[model samples]
Target: MPRLCGRRGNIRRLTRNSQLVQNRWLNRSAEDQLTDNENLRNQIAITRTNESQEQRNERHRVNTLRQRLARQRVTDTL
Candidate 1:
């Protein structure tokens, strides 16, 4: 009877420890997922800003080229 009781106690302790480890792992997983989501959001924002800047640069280049062509046409007519 004493040995049987000791075995039961050991099983209970093992079960409790396993539960604690599982809880810790779950909490860490949630935290890591949240961090990953935030980082992805930041990356998307940066990409949008970079795209906006690139579009503006392209527009400026096109306008400059158009102006240069107009000037060349005028010089040719003269």
Candidate 2:
């Protein structure tokens, strides 16, 4: 007999005289929401892939540059 959201007896009372006058709220256009959802998903996926590629490229560039600088420093110091 325990209710779900910690309101045990409240839902039981509401069910007794329910005329269902609580479900009339249009928040936004469904088409706009759908388009927005699709756009967001695509943007997230593309951004993630671009970021991964950029990270890999940056690592390669940094390692290559560091090695060249280190070799030059060693030759110059010796």
Per-candidate local distance difference test? 0.82, 0.74
Model 1 off-target regions past 4 Å? 1-51
Listed in order, each prediction's TM-score against the native is 0.35, 0.34
- Per-residue CA lDDT of model 2 for 1-78, tens digit only, reads 645664564665565235353332235578867988999999978876778777878878999999999999999999
- For model 1, state the Cα shift of residue 31 in Å: 59
Model 1, residue 35: displacement in angstroms? 48
Residue pairs in clash, model 2? none
**Model 1, range 1-78, lDDT digits (tens) per residue?**
556665566765667678898887677876788998899999988876778777878978999999999999999999
Candidate 1 lDDT at 66 equals 100
Lowest lDDT sum, 10 consecutive residues, model 1, at 1-10
lDDT of 2 at 72: 100
